[model samples]
Target: MARSTGAVGPSGCAATLTEPGAFGGSLGYAQKLSDDDPALPFTPGVDHGYLGVGLDVLGNCFGDWEHRGNGCETTSPAGTAFRIPAPGANMVTLRGPGDGTTGYCFLTATTSNFSTTGPWPSTLPGQLQGPTTSLPAGVTPAAVPSTYKFGFAASTGLFTDVHLIRNVSVHPAAALPQLNLVKQVSAASDVPLPLTPGQQVPYEYVVTNSGNTTLTDVNVTDDRVTGICCPGTTLTSGQTMTCTGTYTVTEADGLAGSVTNTALAHGTTPGGTMVDSPPSEVTLPVQRGPGLRLEKTVDEDRVYRAGDEVSYTYTVTNTGPTELTGIGVTDDRVDGITCQATTLAPGASTTCTGTYTVTQQDAERGNVINIAFARGQSGATTVESPPDTARVDVVTNRPALRIEKSVDDSRPYRVGERITYTYTVTNTGNTELSDVTVVDDRVTDVTCRATTLAPGASTTCTGTYTVTEADAVAGEITNVAVATADNGTVRSEPDQATVQVESKPCHGKDCHKPCHGKDCEPCADQRCEAY
Candidate 1:
């Protein structure tokens, strides 16, 4: 016999032997045992590990099926072939020779056939239970005409003194790949002060391969953020990786009080199949003064079909310490919003309603997602709440656009003062959009950073407007902006932004007027209008 040395097992994957006969090498004659019962198992090789062997068709016998804790009768082992009884289903055969002598045992596992051969009712008859011979990774062993390996141990409970591996000859490893990912905000972001607009929100993602196989082409991404960096794209089995990413908080996120986002992870298997992990989500609190909260929800609890009438409810609350007037909801898809009350006191709230008939185009794409915001006046300042988003199921890859408009200040302004207006355009659908443009009714020249956008991408456009004497007397300036993408084929509903203009006295002066009973700075030509 040839002499050599090596360690082998499911983990080591040290050797591959395939020929209808006994295994050779240091495992040749099999070590002798001094103490224990003869009934213990010496197969599977998980304790030390399995020697990787790829097989096409199997025709040899595997032994000691009864010692694998299967309770198989030593007298009639042939009846142990496990079957599922499924349509056209079959299982491997287990046979024993008529001779009373102990038979040699071999362990086998499947690769591509894992899908059909698994969800096994119990461990294979020849694989041992507990830890010693336990399969690596504790995953269901594939039962098909695939890889075959044998194991010898350093004395099982009832077997003779068997020597563990004593040599070194390794083979290329086989794979059983699985991927797991976890996402969280960096501890540094958790501070006494809530994160504000333009502040950096750091995130960390932990990636791991939960299976026995190596994974390649691994990637991690966030739906609402970008610029993620990981050391490498390949992960060996049982290896863990950490990736980092960042996002800049927006004013909308602050006004809404929180920012929520989801991250996804995926990897490719050797067999070319892609394995994806369930989405992981994290919500970060944002800086905001006590303000209005609009909770928007849909009535549908199930998937929607064509012609479905979707009812949306808007619950507007005065979360601020002061009262708000002109409280109402405005949606991107509906018109004529009706509310229970147009004014809310410090802690008061009211309900608003709207209805939409799902079109076939929307139903086919999956579901509908709409955004809405509320507007109210607190003293002389006109305040608009941040967006309240709602989703049903899905959206088609068709071109779609969304726009959010906001102004630099909410405090009452005097004539001749300039207000900086920001119009943000976003591509919400699953397709790339070209020539994305924002048109504000008030600002004729809106300049944006990018005119093109991929799905879920956004761009900020800015313009400046000078408050006029007419705007001061009107008490406020309401500016509306609409965005268009895909050469105007897709258009967004109008988004309105308002700023309070100082109330003018009997004769309109460019001077700031303190409200209702308070004096107007630099008294106007005439007496003040209020108490």
Candidate 2:
């Protein structure tokens, strides 16, 4: 069989032979296209052979082949195939654009025919091809072809062979980082009502790498919390990292009624490009401090008598948004008063009681005064209830009477001599006195002007009495009187009056006769004379 060589064109182009009937069995010339070409079953014109037989034979052939004596004139021309070897997955890693750097990639294309003009054009998407370069003979020996002079005509000759191609693709790798943040009350893990000062809160941030490339120097930041950094310095595709931070609640937070926090993620690609994730934010509601109230009352009436027992009641209530603890009650006047509930929930109330006994001092003062206090704690703050007071009036009984008695005679009295006695009664008690009367043991027919007497009132009466002979002999007359009030319910000590009777002084004529005249005879020393 006769052997002939075919002319080679640039990679990605079809190779053909112009000589016809070079192979004895064929009546027409054939042209073969690359298998990688999208247009298949290409129709040939009148000067060309049938479709399937021409291109199919050479399209499936690899390396170099020499035809024996089979009457085949020319061999198939070489074709180029493109591929990426370094990054087998067709992906590359790069730093962010901020780094002012770029990522490198290598692409290679192999040819079936040998030629000095090597490498090939590439249609890879989003990539630009670099200058063609040669590979060592040991690297691709099949791509190196043996060159010999082949004559298409007596005066025409050309050089052709298969070529091994290699080219690089330059591009910026993608750098993308995503961030999310969440905030919650550490105690409840939810929005806590009535959140006061000194309460602990927690914040969480999650960072993810969603780009095709790896990220370096990843960092996280929060508006409320500090020291937010990822655990890893570098993150591959679809990798995620989480960080946590804590914050203490403050009075300002409670007053604001809400707390807001924001988180942001930053990273750099190998290409020195700076990238940032969208800011994520979370807001939680805060509750105010507890409100407390107190009310004090008494079971008895406002007025109470001495030696009476009084019961005092105290009520404590919580009216704020949160619960209160360490609740207690106290009264200035009442002792042993305690609240049984140690904790009070919002809009809840509890009651306690204490007892007090009335004393004479209280009665004298006319009223009893007391104050009650209630207190509780909400978070780190202490809350107090408005003070309450209870007043009571006390009463005491008082009834008294007094009397005085006197006799009309001031000189010595004889038997059968008439005398007048007088008596007075007074009520010195706080209340009215009824059935008031006076009695004199030594006098008869003594009565008071009035029977009933009001406080600070007085009554008087008189009676006639005769001096007794025995009283004259004794030289004195005494009368005792006493007063009674409220129908003898109360009595006063006795009052007394006395009259002194002396022996009558004698005149010169009659020694036993009493001095009857104002200028009665007087016993003189020696020159005494009767008048």
Candidate 3:
């Protein structure tokens, strides 16, 4: 069977075959080998076993090319040198006619390396075999009678080890290429409640070859997106590939209330025919309903006073899947709000201006707070946004003053003695007090340190008074002080301080004598004080 080049040679060893009424012709053959046998490398005088398919052998199954030498190969093993299979192997193989070139005696599932294992049991009926050139189904159109060459690759061959032979045959099969497609949005986060306009929407397409043939010119297309691309054009049978593209969200998409897209995948067969997958589509609602955003702001932060003018700005935007009509802003405190347009498209924005005059009541309260909101109509539905509030602080004119009068010395005073007085003036109101001064009925020339008192500030003033003889006779004297500012618009309640006059003991004959005045009349134990 194997090293049996004696059986297969350039000699006339040919078989018979009826021309097929079918499409193309196929080749096949079968034989069993001992476990320890290795159909190995090509070398002269060494028998290597092999079979030929698709091509009619010029010489034999071993390497005997018509263009080159031919024989049972009395001189060489017939083919060039190549190691045979391992001891227990069953199949031996080589590329080309064993002369070493393109044709592989046994084509494997994927790679071009000719050496093959038990790919023998063909899935198709006839169990086709071939020299893997381009197609693995090896369908030859050329007519030829059945031929066989029993030979060896090197030292020993299938002759001695060749054990069993069964159903060995040949036939043809048609190429069937199929394609499948699936599409999906790339990022889950890119889509939210209301998809942002001008944002990128990424998509991925999966292309798969579902049939038993290779496919080329693979591509995908989307009705709503552009620039679809993929990494390669060819997809082997049962292989998959991914394609990608991006679509930008537009204002029109929002206005329509939803975005709908469809995609189709296409591929070309090796025969230059086109095949298409079923159309796929995805649709999503842009937003639930019409949306409005209102923002209100004052023109400036300057402190306001009574009758002060403040401008309010109302900015309105239409964020939605529909148009807004009869749009305007309203405020509880601001009046006569005017906008540029009565209708707005989705994603459109406009601003309106109005003025509010600060009244005396608002000034007294120190702030002007108002609530404002925007409203619009979408078809038959009336929509309004959440109210926005704006506040303006105003200055209140409430000026006040306070003063306290006190004697510089702490105790009893003598007649005709100089007494120094101190007056403190404080601004107790929120406003500044100008022309602030203190006045005392008994103390004269109250020189003030400052004529103006800022809010929450204090100023000191000084004055001097002399103890009169009458004051000494009265035993005690009191004086009042009041602060005045801003032409009496601000005044303080009067504050007073009193000092006692000390009584002198009568040292002369008056010690036992009664006195007329209270101060000089009498003291304890008949004593008298002189003024």
Provide the clashing-pair count of each candidate structure.
Answer: 15, 27, 28
- Measured against the true structure, the TM-scores of the candidates, in listed sequence, are 0.26, 0.26, 0.36
Give the per-residue lDDT digits (tens) of candidate 1, residues 1-531: 121121232221112332121232112212111111122223322222223221111211221222221211221122122222311111222221110112212232322232233332223333221122223454322322122245332212222343434463534255432677777766335432345566677887777787777889888989988888888998888777778899888879877888999998888888888888668787867756656777787843333546667889998877565789988899998788899999998657899999887787775534476889988988888877778777664222456789988876648898998899888899876567998888888888889899999767899999998988778767799988899877788999999988889855543332245333334433433345543
Residue 326 lDDT in candidate 1: 88
Cα lDDT tens digits for candidate 3, 1-531: 221111221111121221111110111221211110122222222112123322212112222121112111121122221223221122222222221211222222222223323222222222223333353456221222122234212221323343233453432243322777767676333343345466577777767787778888889999998999899989998787778888887778767777889998898888888988777676765644687778888843255668878899988877676899999999999889999877889878889889999999886544577889999999999978778877665655556787877775477998888888888888877566888878789987889999987767898999888887667657787888899999876789999998898654554446546654455443433455443
Q: How would you encode candidate 2's per-residue C-alpha lDDT over 234-255 as one tens digit per residue?
A: 7787676666677776668768
RMSD values, in order shown = 35.8, 53.7, 41.1
Candidate 1 lDDT (Cα, whole model)?
0.56
Shift of residue 18 alpha carbon in model 1, Å: 27
Task: Specify the highest-TM-score model's number.
Answer: 3
